[model samples]
Target: MYLYYSFIRVFKYLCRERERRGQTMYLRSAARGFLAFLLLVSALHGYHDWTVTYTSSTVCALRGSTVEVSCSYEYPDKLQNRSTPVETLWFTKEDHSQPGGLVSDTDYAGRVERSCEEHSCSLSSCSGNCTLRIRDLRQSDSAEYKVRFITNQPGGEYTGDPGVKLTVTDLKVKVPHWIRLWKYLECQSMCVLSDHPNYVWYKNGQHAEREITKMFYIKEGDSVSCAVEGSERFHSPLVCAKGIKNLCNKVTYSTRTMCVLQGTSVDISCTYSTYRGLKLKEKYWYAWSNNNEPTDLQKDSEYKGRVQYPVKERGGSTLKITDLRDTDSAEYRFKYKSKSHEWKSALHGTTLTVTGLRVEGAAVAPVTEGQRVTLSCSTRCLLPGQTSYIWYHNKGPVAEPESTMNKLVLDPVGLQHAGSYSCSVRGYPHQSPEETLTVSCIMCILCRD
Candidate 1:
């Protein structure tokens, strides 16, 4: 069962690594081919008893707050009876030169804790769970975390790969737009908080009735801010609701930053207002240039075919970019022209980050017959939603029981499985670099003996 699980993990690693590295199409094609072969092998073997399951694959938390990541694991009772756990560790980074680095050894030294429980399960298996708690979260603490345990048996260490991803974000008070009557304000973060925490609103630097909601209303000229209920110290920056006179010249973006996968599409939008009765002459989106000037995206040759200005309602405009490329990453600002005035705020605009997928692990490795193998798909940033991955062998797609799964497993590998492998996100053309799988025949070794 452990062998079977290991194969699955390997496949997942390959897929993930490929996406993260954003390798070229040739490499990605080869890696997909290898992953497909592994998936075929695992499908023939069926289920495995050894497994590790995380309560949540992704978590979002506020800076300065506390968070807990938990998972449960199961192993065959036969191994449990003969082997005892020698070590258990939780880590954000894996060190190939040694065992994985513990969270405690990192900057989290005084703020991390771990707890575990173990018990027998149905006499044929043993089950256990472990929870990792991190306090006073820092923005730098955002990372993918994995748990590993070692047993007394030879080659008895296992790690939960494609582990939990943690995102730490600061609070921001979304300024109310004129359409909302300039009365409502919202507390925002990059990702949804895992705890679904209550929010505390502040008016003019003072607690506003200890408000327990994410949205709030403010009077003209009043400044509003927000924080998690118990974390008032980390409140968001203040935003002034300065009436029409101040709002008439302002532009407000829907978001400050966006992370997207290469080959995907993204839309960045904003709302703007001009002095009353001013005839709007022109409106457009532009990216910052090295010359300290804003170049209209529509006029730029680089964005000619890929850029579109989706017509929006009265005060809103959207910049849509399709088939995203890494080179597209930049700060984008919105500008509008009136007959007598041009509005372009000194404040920063939206930032877009484009990441490509790359498969990780060795490009070529010799596998002995009957050895378990795994491949994985990965990305630099934890993708926003559940991502579906496609595996390829040689140059064509590989058939698998679960087409959406990012992992490919080969249990008890055979010579027929040797090939070039690659992986890609479903619905996207980008793929990870190819990985070559080489198989060594066990019968040949026996014959020599």
Candidate 2:
């Protein structure tokens, strides 16, 4: 403050001397310009001490989360002081209009502490400076905040501004029990508690802007998280936000780990406590085929892997499998009684299978009318082993002379033979879709169908 005031004073003296000496016009103009610059810098800082009536802001947080409220000021250089003259008192305004007392005086002044701050705001650049940090958050502490500035100048001590409205909001989360998000599946989920349109999701503490699966879908490896509207991501337990009602509200997320089972392989893992560190257990694999059936302990017809445990030294019976087959899939059951008499029953069931598409070139096309003809066709069982085929036309099966195998034969060909022909092969997964041969002038016969 003194430096700028001194510069202004010197500039005014120079201007007066120039006028008195009838100095060059340039000299007088330079003095005036310097004085104006100094004054502008000082006046800009004064704006910071005004009422916070320009904009109303809101902040959203969680039950046990923290948030920072920012305040900036612009004022004249002459008004700044190096020492903390006027105390910066930030308090919750339960109801500024209430003739009664506030409700949140519960050790708030002590629990709240500033985590980030800045006062470098020059009279000119400090327009966006002041801020306060509050931590160890609680839901009951939610309310509006009011800030006031006091200054003790050489002339007198005074106060500036009042009721800088800052609305506090809360966050609510419902992550029921176990949640299993799928792997390798395009999946995303979020916990939203912001009024802003900007939505964000996080997994393992990283920004996931493209994820749309917000509490929408679940499969295996993935977990769920969220953010307040203005938040970049919910990297923290609570999501802080602005521009919202119930503004400080926030929720956290968690997910259940997956139990992966494949046709030829069963890979299981559990998080618990063990002595020698969790390892494999020599146990029989038992499972049912569908949801309707009760859990069966009768050993499966064919099993691939043993019961595996995750996070060594934990007690859990999870199954893992490799080199699987279609029939190897079913509802698996396991039982574990800890060393103590405490026995708990937990069941995790999932049916696993791989989707496959196959195409087997049929026998050759029937003979063409105008050319010496040759006919060829073939039948195949797309699934692993069931090999059986049958030919069908507009009606049902065009069975052979009471034969066993499926076959296709072309008679003396002609223009009329150039019609629709189809073949059917059966077994495994689901039924195979019918493939057709649309014989165009298909001597030029390259049918896409």
Candidate 3:
């Protein structure tokens, strides 16, 4: 008989075999049989002496984001004493007897990571604490995963049962009927996430602050959208009231123009605001060419590894470029996309000028006491504009008469003037490395001789 049928027969027999005088003997016998069956089944499955636990049996995550699943495992003292775990991994299939059965299958290549803490066999707690992290989640990536390990001892392999189950979902915004003009709009997902993450609201397409209650009030001709916090890419479709969509569009650069030295790094910053209901499809930097349309600099071979777009705040982003060259001088602009595209290139952009910087006077030289010396700071090109220079003596600001002067003069140099000196361009963050100046007291030296 099939194992399932045999269990059914045993259950039926237990039900029919009533003890005389309605005593509890039948119940006791049934309980003992069930316990014995469980033990037999476990032994048959090679799980007789091991225990595994999952922090959460189920996990729900948004598409295009990342998630983590946590787990732990333990084994018998006899196995611990005789063997040591050499390889630990996670898989979605029990046929690990074959290759390519890992949970990080071809479909999830380069997107899955597993981390575990190594533990000695003699430890009383779990032998391993493992966590699985997956990035750029997709609908097809959802599945149940199991933890497995191989030991150094001969024929020592184990797989944990009842592993974690994962589900990926997309976000959506729920709007009420237009009849109620001032009702609340809801940001929802197809299924509830593991921990019920906070929701964020957007109007016209730009991200607003997080909504504590996952609700936004509706107004006439207003288009509102919503997304889960930290998973903005998986936002829901826009829900508009009064059958009209409001267009919210604005972009402004922190400074219209800036100048920097070649071989240095510079940051171009900007703040933007967009309509609530529109979704941002793309964001990038571009520069105008000679009589041609602007070209995206990100794809240019020149900026392959020298450009960075740091994480943006709610309404701002920064572009940082290093190892700048004269050729890098151009008009730089930030552009973003939405479902309802708006092209306003003329209103938002920054002009950058790259020039070489250097100190004009001798950095290090011996000077006689009572002699006068002059140190001047200069740049290679002054077409863009002349920048005021700030001089420092011994790592501190220069004296009042020499302050804010590109050319610093020290008359009647004394022993006290024998120290380090440096200069920097005003409004620039970097300063030249300090140069040492040696002043000699010939009279004192002659006396010592």
Candidate 4:
């Protein structure tokens, strides 16, 4: 699962990069073809005899959360008849036959759990598939894990090499020094989280709204912190915005992140200030790119007619993008220079995500009558503001009162529910492409006989 998830993240990142650069369809095709080749290689490597296949090569899990490492193994079926009894062990240290190197023998005694496909062989014997689970993970638990199986037959001892590596990390609130009215705080981790979990924010120990952005203004004494949605107890340390004393030479954005619809317009704004005596020389907005020097948006040909820097207000600047495209998604930052000093926040800038609506769960195999079906309005990221959904049946609006919900669930669906469906958000003019739902009835087929 981790390997597959990693592939998905890579693919999405590549796609966004290509789209943002307005690359040709050929490039996109090449990316997909390369990914397919990798998948084929992985499949071939996993099916060989006397092989152990792990779900993921590496995993990054949050500290305090449970971690499960799973693997499946295959050996000659002849081993089933052996009388010596097979022994399987999961360990992080050097391999030992059985009684020595197991995780249970280490510091993880109470928190470690081992399970396998064969329940009868509980102590250490297992065949086919096995899993190791650890609770209340700590940073010290980060290590390479392997499973070794031993048999009485000559040359029957085998250990899976290059085992899964686990990295445990804790969330931290990154506070950026900003002299602007808006202060943006980021919840950061040392490793990328494959699941892309939702974040929960807290202000002065009070829960904040789900839709609030990190760019929201903070009062002088207010302290803010964040945690992953499911693990609120393990939140980051609260960092007070007022505690930042050296805000004299910093640039800060209006928001740390945004998700906007395609074809719409967006404004990426920021404010900056330097030491009292420093003279302002230049100020501009630039999109971040790998190993490339920042260039002014107004001078970039890629954004020829689409980008504009509106009139500056006091100490603020805004980059207005019109006729937005999916390729416009990128991290943008503001920079200012004085005669003797230049400043751009060392922290990351605003991340803009452009997305389109789509109806999911519509192309499943035909649903049988009397079975429930759910269709959802899906977006890459949540859109800004109070978002309400509007559903459509065929080309007309759905008359059901609950059609306003993001999900349309039909309980014990009937033939009448079969049709083309689409969805759109309220206040947005665009609607998703139509998807057909087919319902099959056993009674109707019997009646025909």
Q: Which candidate wins on lDDT? A: 4
lDDT of 2 by residue, 53-154 (tens): 313355655443456666654333344545434334555543463321122243452245542243444542223244566654555666666554444434
Where's the lowest-lDDT run of ten residues in candidate 2? 249-258
What's the ranking of the predictions by lDDT, best on top? Answer: 4, 1, 3, 2
* Preferred candidate (lDDT higher): 1 or 2: 1
In model 1, what lDDT does residue 376 have? 63
- Put the candidates in TM-score order, highest first: 1, 4, 3, 2
- The pairs that clash in candidate 4 are 20-327
Question: How much is 96 displaced in model 4, in angstroms?
Answer: 52
Candidate 4 residue-wise lDDT, 100-178, digit = tens: 5545353664357788775233233334788999876779899998987766655676788889999999888886656
Model 1 score (lDDT)? 0.73
Give the per-residue lDDT digits (tens) of candidate 1, residues 161-212.
Answer: 8899999999898764644443556788999976677888766445565544
How high a TM-score does candidate 3 get? Answer: 0.45
Residues 159-244, candidate 3, lDDT per residue (tens digit)? 66778888888877665443444555666666678767788777645566587444445555455666776755456655555543
What total of clashing residue pairs does each candidate reach?
A: 47, 60, 12, 1
Error of 2 at 34 (Å): 27
Q: How close is candidate 1 to the true structure, as a TM-score?
A: 0.50
